[model samples]
Target: MEIVRPHSHRNLFSSNDAASAPTIPLYRSAPPLEVRLEDFESFAIDRLRVLKGISDGLSRGKKPDEMEKLVSELWKVNMRHQHASEVLNKDIISHFVLRLVYCRTEDLRKWFLSMECALFRYRFRFLTAEAQRAIMDEFDITCKAVNIMEFESIKEKLGQVARSMGQPLPTGDAIFYKVPFEDVPELVAGRRVLLSQGYAYVAMNQVVSLVATLFRSQLSKTLILTNRKWTSSIREQEKHRLTPIVEALCSSYLGPDFSQPKEYAEISLKDIDQLAKTSFPLCMRHQFDKLKEDHHLKHGGRMQLGLFLKGVGLNLDDALAFWRAEFSKKVGLEKFEKEYAYTIRHNYGKEGKRTDYTPYSCYKIISSTPGAGDHHGCPYRHFSEENLRAALSRMGVNSRAMEDVMNKVRNRHYQLACTLTFEALHGVPCDAGINHPNQYFNDSQKILQPKKDSST
Candidate 1:
């Protein structure tokens, strides 16, 4: 494939030869090539990791510079290729793969759209002025530059809007673009641009927001169209091969294998009670408490808590013993061994399918819906506000910290709320935020038992 590389040394704000510059993709059309299934899966996963990083950083309230640094590091590790052409190919192919994967459901579409827009904005910021203009032209984003007379007429209003938005006042020489106010509602809503007669006067620096608006609009429509096409035609034809891959990509957990605890500390049954207090996330801690109190747990709770124990380094023998001991208190050893023993072994890949089930991430836990008697799901997501508050209080979280967590929960940022809870309990900042229950446990252990080399 022929790839046109943008000028490496050109500053984002500086002009370059527009004819030779490669613009960041709008992902309007699919790449015309046959990709190996292995490469196809790899490309989709790499792009998914990037989008996941963007989602994580935004949810944690990372500023633009912090988000930029985070994304840059992720791109270097996951998306960068040895050759420019390979990089371009992966970029295009990965986007299309994810579009197919995420276009399945409304929730998936919204998430994909949001993260892709963020990725676009991040990449667009680093493009040279010429490359950006090339994109604008290619996409037919016709935002007319205001003439000197119109600029002079709106100069005072623009200055006032800029002042209100804490931006520097625009000078007479500064260029402004006139786009329909509907096209850049965010800029108008934030009072970052001057508006007159249904048009927004956007300064050059703010044009990225305008362009982002256009990119988002275009991508949103494309996703819906792609979904309609997939439903009407693609589903039946590709059900066996490509469809399965797309479905797996949507539901797959791309994080570390928590089932294998080779690097983590060895956890014994004797250590579980103390560890629950110090290391468990709120969800695990809740389940632990419930199990001890009732001496029995529903299937949902058992699976959730059982897999978490496995992740924390409970060996198969210890796992069996732990469940047998807990259940024997209510049902005698005969009944316990008959009913519950196999289930525990199954989680260790000892029975049925012989698949080593990994511990649930926050996403998995939050996505699950617990019933009236269930204790499986994420507490931050499943608990009523009153119940959540009570749970926090029981953990000795102060009123102020509880409120902070509640606010994040209220906004539907469950993982962030969990992170806040972690910070409150640990008395240290959780910079990356918590993604999995096991991650929370690992992070807590690191803080409580600092490594000897680090101490030195």
Candidate 2:
């Protein structure tokens, strides 16, 4: 520990036992560069969880606003989860390449389709006549593409997708009456194409537009709708109300669209982190950048550090440890723990008893965020390309394996990434040893005893 500003008061936990208790490793069991460098998107797996919803519902109009408001209200009520949500919304999406891989069997996949349609059709229903025909045409192309194999399984899955889309059958010519929306002239007689096709970029456009609209309306009323000559008291009232609304407006503006309605929730962390570097709040990036430069860390490393600190409900001591390990070699520990550590901790979430906590492990690092400060997770701009390469190299990975994993992530193969990484690391399936990263970490803490160099 760095020499402190000597205090006349003896400290509470700074005794020999405290120092001897083994300062929790700020970098224990840190996988080698190879293990840590699984495509940057891996860091975003949990952080971008909320984007899946934002990405999907963004196309809806008034409803997405209501949804967002509801989410905001939920955050207000469960302040404990706020940090986690923020992590998901901003931090995770900014870094990881999150995606959904369709790896279901034909019949099962079809059932999945039915479930989705049943769930989302009210908001983004079956395709319209023009769009349906277009989809059918595309379906023909897809079918042709699948001639590589029997593709019967794919055919069934496509049929499921069609059904989920509210199409009665596969987007193919079946021996049945093709019920085109064109057939129901009355359906379109007055509905001004109230919505667009499913394949359209619906989510970001719609949600963002609605949020934009409501935000603007609220802003105009609160900030600009006044006669400039209002009394001081009235102006004060307006200012008080306007401030929060304005902030919400700015947030909504930054948020994804709610109108266009398509959810390609393939979180591309590299892209988003770059955006954070270029566009996010300045105070945020410093915390992670410090970690990166000092620790030779990558984007994932920064994210992991942020996430673990957040997850463990780290107090001032642990928070200080984090910066000490990451930045001491560069700036010295005193500067961080006394100055930066407190700032980072305060930003992480509320400190004190009954605070939100999750296991500090790869899983939580990958999947925990509460959207507000209560539940912690995420470090700003923590990971970048260079550090990521180093971390992956240490983890027994190479350019070829990294390439394979990254490609899989780009293709939205979440499960496959987990499966492949596990196989590569353990020479066995993940199920062979432990089920989840949480389980692995719990066991590792016991099995992989703290080394002389490791933190307790």
| TM-score attained by model 1 | 0.89
What value of lDDT does candidate 1 attain over all alpha carbons? 0.84
**What tens-digit string does per-residue lDDT give for candidate 1 at 246-314?**
888977777786887755758877888888988899999999999888889999999999999999899
Per-model TM against the reference: 0.89, 0.28
Candidate 2 C-alpha lDDT tens digits along 128-159: 44443333342231211223242333456445
Residue 122 displacement in candidate 1 (angstroms): 2.2
Q: At residue 427, what lDDT does model 2 achieve?
A: 47
